[model samples]
Target: MAKIRLADALVKILEKEGTKFVFGHPGEQILPFYQALQNSSIKHILTRHEQGAAHAADGYARSSFQPGVCVASAGPGALNLVMGVATAYKDSIPLLVITGDVSSQLKGENVFQDVDINAVFEPITLQSHLVKEPQEGIQLLKMTILTLKTGKTGPIHLNIPRDVLQMEVDQSLLDETVELNLPNDWSNLKPAEKLVENSKKPLILAGAGVLWAHAVDDLHVLAEKHRIPVATTYPARGVLSEDHPLSLGLLGQRGTKAANFAGKNSDLVLAMGCRLSERTLKGLGDVPIIQVNLDEKVLKGSVNIQADVKKFLEKIRKTPPKNTDKWLEQLSKHPKTHKIRTNFKKTPLKPQRAIKEILEGKDDSILVNDAGSHTTWVNLLIKALESPSLIFSGGLGPMGYGVPASVGVSLARPDKKVVVVVGDGGFQMTLQELATITELDLPIVICLINNRSLGIIRQWQELYYGAPFQVELDNPDFVKLANAYHMQAKRVDSPDDILSAVKDALKLNKPVLIEVIVDENEDIPLPE
Candidate 1:
C-alpha cells in the first residue's frame, strides 16, 4: 500500500502495455516525466522538433504495428506537433501523445507557455483529455491507449500539468479497471461473402488503415486466394511489398500507371481500410465501390457494400472471385510511367534522376519527403525496401516534414538505412536540427533537391496563374552548413556525376547531406 507519484503510475501503465520507447522533446514543463524515466524501463528518444516526435512515433507504429508514444512541452511544442497530429488523424495512424502543461493554478491566466492545447487539437484527434488530478493520470493513460484500438484509429492526447506529476497516488487506485471499447466482431462476413461471390474483376485497394489494422498478412492471403491484383494508397506504401507479383504498386494521382488503370477499369473495387480520396478516385463516375472501414460513415457514398476489413476478408475466404486472368492481363499491359525522363545535360542535374540514383544505391532505405516538387519525384520514383518503410506528412504535406520525420524514422529503425529527400525551401524550416542529428548520433542520409524555387506552387502557377511569380529561393551552402554541425556532406550538380557521388554517400554511413542543384524551369510531367 505504498504511495506512488502520478508520473510513476503513468510510466508503469505504458511499460505494462509493452511501450518500448517514447519519442519526445524535453523542456522545463516536462522535466518531471524525464526525471521519472530514470527509474522506469521505458526508453526516451529526444527529437529535434515536436513534429518529428509525432512522425517518429507514427513511423514506428506503422512499421511495428504498435501504439507510438510522443510527448511535448506546452505551447509552441504542442503547436509544432499539430501538423503531424492532423496527418495521423487523416491517415488513421494510432498514436498516444502525452503533453506537459503549465500548472493548474495558472490555468486561463494567459500564463507563459500556455496556449490551449485542447482547443488547437480538438478537430484533429479521436480523444483529448486534460489531467487535473493525480489519480486521473493512470486512468487517462489506459483510456488513451485503448482508444487506438477503436474504430477509425487516430491520435489521442493527454494534457498533463506540472503539479500532477509530483502528486502522491494511492496504490488501490491502480486496481481501477478502464474499459477498452475496441471492435472484436470483425469476424462476421455474410455481407462480404455475398459481395465477393457476385463480383467479377474485383480489385483490392489497401491503405494506411491496413497497417493500423495489422491485417496485411490477412490481406495478402485473401488476395492470393482470389487472384486479386492488389493496389495500395500513397500512405500505405509498403503494406504489400512492391516486389509481390500481386501488388500493382501504389494507386492514386502520383501512383503507378498499372494501379490507376487497373483500379479505374475494374468492375468492382474492394477498397479495404481506405478512404477513397480524390487522389485514388482520379475521376469517379459510378465505379461500384466496396468500402470496408471501421468508420461506418465512410461507407455512405458510391459504396455498394461495407464491413470491417478483417471480417470482410475472412468472410470472402469461402466465396471465391471469378477468374480475372483476362482482366489482370489487361492491367499488366498498362504502360509503366514510373520512370522520369528529363533533359539535364547542359544545366543543373535532373532532380528526378538524382532521386532515382539514390533509390538504386539504397534500395532498403527509409525515404521521407518534404512539401515541394521533389515530393512529386520521390513519390513517383523512390522504391521502398521491405524493412524500414516509406514516410511523409501526406495529409498536411508540411514543409519541414522531411528533416524531422527522418530523425524519428532513424531513431525508431536505427538498424536500417534512413534517407530524407527534401527541397531547399522545406529544409530551412527545421535545418537547425542538423545539430540534433549529430548529438543523437543518428546516421540519416539527406538529399536536398535544391531547385531554388517553390516548386509545387510553381506547378500550380503554371497550370492556373499563367506564369510563376515570387517562387524563387536563394539557397545556402548546404555542405558548409552540414560541416558546421560536424556531419559529412556533398553536392552534386552535374547529371553525369550524380550516380557516382551518390554511391560515395551510401558508403559514408554517417549523417550526410547531398544538395543536388536543378534548373528552375524543369517541370514534372503530368499524364496526357
Candidate 2:
C-alpha cells in the first residue's frame, strides 16, 4: 500500500481501466495530472482546443464501444466541452470527462479559473462527482468506470481540486474493484415474441443504443429471421447493411425515402434501443410501437421490454422466423429510394456525386461526417455495413466535429482506415486538429467538400427570405492549410478529378485531405 500522489493514482486508475489515450489540452491547473501521465502507459492526445478534445473522445467512444476519456481545466476549458459532451449524452455515447478545479478551500470564492464544474455538467451526464480528497476521488473514479461499463451508458464527469490531485493517497486503494449489481429477466422476450408473431407488417427501428450495445449482429439476426424491414435512426444508419434487402435505412429529417415510406405504413414498429422521439418517429402516424431498451424512461410503447437490446434480440432469435412477404411486396411496389442527382460529368462538383464516388464500392469503410447539408447527402448515400460505420453527431449536431472525430476514430480503429466526409462550413470548425492527424501519421482520408456557403441555411434563406447573410465563407486555401500542418493535401474541382484524387489519397497510406470544390448553389431540397 505505497503512498503516491492522488494525481499519480488517478493516472494508474485510468491504466487499470484499459484507457489507451486521453484527449485534452493542457492548462496550468491540470498540469499535476498531466505530469502524472508522463511515466504512464496511457497516451495523452493534445487537441488544439478543449472542444476538439471532447469531440475526438466522442468519436473514440462511438467506434470502440468503450468509454472515451477527455480532460480539461476548470472554468472556460471545462465549459468548452459542453457541446461535445451534450452530443455524446444525447446520442448515448459513453464518455468520461475529467476537469481540474480550484482547490477545496477556494470553492465559491471565485478563485482563478474556478467554476462549479459538477453543477454545470449534471444535466448532461449520467452522474457528476466532485472530489474533495485523493482517496475519495480514486473511489469515485472506480465506481464511475463501473457505471460506464454497465447499463444505460452516457457522459459522466469528475471534478478534482488542484490540491486534492497532488495530495498523497494509499496506492492499495487503486486495487479495489467496484462490483456490479446487474439484474436480468428473460420473461419480457415471451411477450415481445408474441407481438412479433401477431403482427404481419412489422418494422424494426434501431437507434444509437444498438451501437452502444454492440448488438448489430443480434439486430440483423432478428430482422433477417422475421423478414422485418429494418430502419435505423440517422446515427445508427449502419446497424444493418444499407444494401440488404431488409434494410430501409434511416428515418428522420435526414431520413431515406424508403425508410420514411416504410415507417409510415408499418402496422407494428419494433423500436429497438431507440427513444421514439419526435424526429425518429417522423411520418409514422399512430403506429403501435414495441420499445426495447435498458432505460425504462424511454419504454413508452404499447409493448415495453426493459432489457439490453442485444439480449432481447438474442432471446427472440431463438424463436421461429416469421414471414411478411405479402407486406414487403406491397411496400416494395412503391418508390422507396431517394431521388438523388447523379451527374458525375458536371464540374463545380455535386456533393452527392463526390460522396458516391468516394464510397460507392467500399461497403466496409468506417465513415464519419459532420453536421451540415453534407450530413443529409452522407446519410442518403452511405451504405453502412454495420453499426458505427456511419458515425456522426445526430442529436446535438455540431459543426467541426468531423476533423477531430477522425483523430479519435483513427486511434481506436488502427486496422480500418477512417473516411471523413465534411463540408467547408463544418470542416473549418475543427481544421486546427490537422496537426494532430499529421503528427500521429494516422490513416485518415479527409474528403473536404468545399462549397462557399452554409448550404442548408443558405438554401432556406434564398427560398424563404430571398436573402443570404452570414452564410458565405471567404475561406483560406485548404490545400496550403493542410500542407502547413505537414500533411499531404489535394484540390480537385471536376467530378472526373474526384476519382483520381480519392485514389491518390487512399494510396498515400498516411493522413491526407482532398478539398473537393462542390457546387455552391446546389439548391438542395428538403427531400423525403
Candidate 3:
C-alpha cells in the first residue's frame, strides 16, 4: 500500500469538514503543501496578494456560511495574511489559515525566509499552532477547524514546516480525523422564553452570528411571533429583508432614530450574536440585556445564554406568547423620514447624494464598504435591498478588502449586483484589483468617495489630534485609473449626477468606477 504524507492527511481532514475551496498565494516554504494539494479535490484560487487571499476567504466564508480557507508561505507571505486573519478574528468569521513556516530544526535560528509564523498570528488568532511533525499536522488542522466553528467562530492559524509536509505518514493516521461536537445546552431556553414572553417592549438585535448559525428565517419567525422589532449590526446587513415589518434596518449611532429609541426603551434586549460594540450600543444606560452567543465570554454581561442562536430560537418558538399585536404596532409606527439632507459643502455634488442615487432603488444589491471616514455615509444610509447582501471586513477594518472582496463576492453569487464603496485612501490599498474585476467580467460598481485625505484620520485630527500631518493625500484620477484597467469610468461632481451615474453603471452590467469628490473637512458626528 502507498504510504500517505502528512500534507495529504491534512487535506483529507479539511475535505471531511466540507471545505471545497482555498484562497492562497504560492511561495517557496509552502511548495510541499501545494504539491500535496495537487491530487486533492479542493480547488485553489491563486490571489495577487496574501491579503487578497485572506479577504477572498473571508468573503467566501461569509457568502457560503462555511469556514473560509487561506494559505500563505513563510516570511512576507505569512506577514501579509495577518491583517486578514485579524479581520476574520474581529468579525467572528470562521477561517482556517494554513501557513508554511521554516523547518522545526532551523526554527528560531534566523534562516532564509524564516520568521515565526505561529508567533506572528498569536495576537490575532483564537488558537494557533506550529506543527513540528507531519503527524502533528493532522491533529492541529482538525482541531483548528473545530475551534473556529465553536465558541465565537473566528480565525485559526496552523503553521506547517516544510519538512513536516514532506514527511511520510501511515494510513492509520487518517483515523485521527475527528470532528469536535458542539455542546447542546437547552438549559437556558425556559428562562429566555419567559423573558421574551413577559416583556412589554421586546427587541431583537441580530448580528453576523445569526447568519453564521443559519438562523435568519428562524429568528425572523420568532420576532414576528413575539412582535419583536428587529435591528441588525452593520455586518449583518441582510439577515432579514429590510422591507419586512419587523426589520428596523440598522441599529445604533447611524441607525434610524426609531431603531435607536426602540433599543433604548426595550425591556428585553435579545442581543443574539451581536458584540454590543460602541457602534451598536447607542449609549447603554443600564438596559436589561439578554445575550445569546456561542462565545461564553459574551455571556458574562446582563443575562447570559450560552448557546447557538438557532437552538435558543427553536425553544422560544415552542412557547412564544400568543399576543404581540400591541408591541408590533408600536414598532411599526416608528416613523420613516427623508428630511435630513447633509450640507457638507456648497458643491452641488454631495457624496451622500451620489451614494443615494447610485444605490437608490434596487434593494437586492450587495455593498462592499471599505473603511475610512468617507464610508460613514454608507453606514448611516445604506439600506437592505430585495436580495441578500454581504458587508465585509468590519472587524479588521482594513482599507484594501473592498475591491478584492467584491471580486470574491461576485464570484460566489454571480447574479446579484455587487457594489463596492471605498474612500480614496482605502481604494489605493488594492486599486490594482480593478484588473481582477475587469478580467472576471463581474458587474461590480466601484463607487470611490474621493475626499483627498485620509478621512478617518482627519476626523480624528479635528476631534482629537488637533493637528493633521500626513493625513492629506494627492489622489490619482480614478476615472483614468478605471480606463487604464479597461473598465468604464465616470466622475461625478454634482449630487444630481449620482443617480444617473449609478443607473448607467448598473445598466452596463460590467465593471465601472464612479468617483465622487467630496469636501475633505466634512465630519460625520456620532450620536451621543
TM-score, every prediction: 0.93, 0.94, 0.91
Q: Which residue pairs clash in candidate 3? A: 349-494, 349-495, 363-385, 363-386, 364-386, 364-387
Local distance difference test, per candidate?
0.77, 0.83, 0.78
Which candidate has the top score in lDDT? Answer: 2
- Cα lDDT tens digits, model 2, 88-200, are 88887889999998888998998888888888899999888898878788888888888787778888899888899999978788787777665455566677777777787
Ranking by lDDT: 2, 3, 1
Query: What tens digits encode model 1's per-residue C-alpha lDDT throughout 1-528?
Result: 889888878887788788888988888787788888877788787777887788778767765667788898888888888878887787777889888889999878999998898988888988888899998888888777776864568898888898888788887777778886544444335555555677777878887777766677889898888889888887877777787777888787877888888777777777888887877777233566767777665664344344457766676666787788887788778744486664447666777777777667665676777788888877777655442377876776778777876766776677777778888998998787787678877778888888888987888898988998998887778899989989898888887776676667766778888888887777887743
Question: Residues 1-528, candidate 3, lDDT per residue (tens digit)?
Answer: 468878777787777787787888999888888887898888777778888888888877777677889999999999999888898888888889988888879988999988877887897887888888777777777777776665469888888888888888787877765677666566766677777667787778888888888888898788876677787887887687777777877787677766777787777788888888877876234577778888776564477787888888887776655476776677667752234475444584566665666567334678787888656767666667432474767756888888877876776677787888888998899787787678768898988888888977877777777888898898877898899999999887877677677877888889989898776776766554
Error of 2 at 86 (Å): 1.5
